[model samples]
Target: MRWTAFLCRLAVGGIFVYACLDKIQHPQAFAVDIHNYRLVPWALLHPWAHYLPVLEATAGLALVLGVARRGAALVLGGLTVVFIVAIAMALLRGLDISCGCFDTDGGHGVGLDLLLRDLVLLLACLPPLLVRDSGPALEQLWRGRP
Candidate 1:
């Protein structure tokens, strides 16, 4: 169980790190991408686009390192839920846009693909929250460690 949790953290955290790096490497392009989403109001878009990558990278690093792991996981998980809601709202409104999530360049538009990807990732976010509190009991049962 511990190993599984570790692997899950690594997977989720690694993707977040990659996402942040992608945005940081191209904040201007990323800003354009965020604008394309039409999700953020025009006025708020610039600040969000500029700052989100930093948050994602910092939180992701913390999750991967097990440093303030619970807090990091909580924030990351909450963000994932927000993404899910945004995607769902986009689809509901019939607005075509790019997910801009780990996007390839700035060409792609948000679609069922992005929606499904986020949905799957949301599943990954759950185990950490669900099992984190109960982990010690399982560890003791397995006699893995103190």
Candidate 2:
């Protein structure tokens, strides 16, 4: 169970970190991607673009490093839900747009496959959130555990 949680943390955290990298580097491009979703208000688009990636990166690093793992899991899980909603809304509205998951530009289009992937990632957030002790984490080392 502990090992499972640890692995889940690594997978979820690593994914978020990877997903945010391009966005952090190119906020303008990310804002365009967010614009394609048509969900965020025009007034809030730029601020969302500027901060969302940083938030993802911060939570992701916390999870990966085993500091505040549960908190990070909660945050990432919430973000995944938002992603799912955005993708679903886009599909329902018949708008074709890149997911902006891993890349801010020229990424894969939003579809059932992407939705399913986010669902799976959402599920993956559970273990670390539920399990109290994830094995071999930095938290354990910090507390002087072997």
Over the stretch 36-63, how does candidate 2's per-residue lDDT look in tens digits?
A: 9999999999999989999999999999
lDDT of 1 by residue, 14-36 (tens): 88998888788787788887776
Which 10-residue window in model 2 sums to the lowest lDDT? 137-146
- Count of backbone collisions in candidate 1: 2
Off by over 4 Å in 2: 141-146
Query: What's the C-alpha lDDT at position 142 in model 1?
Result: 50
TM-score of each: 0.80, 0.95
Error of 2 at 97 (Å): 0.6
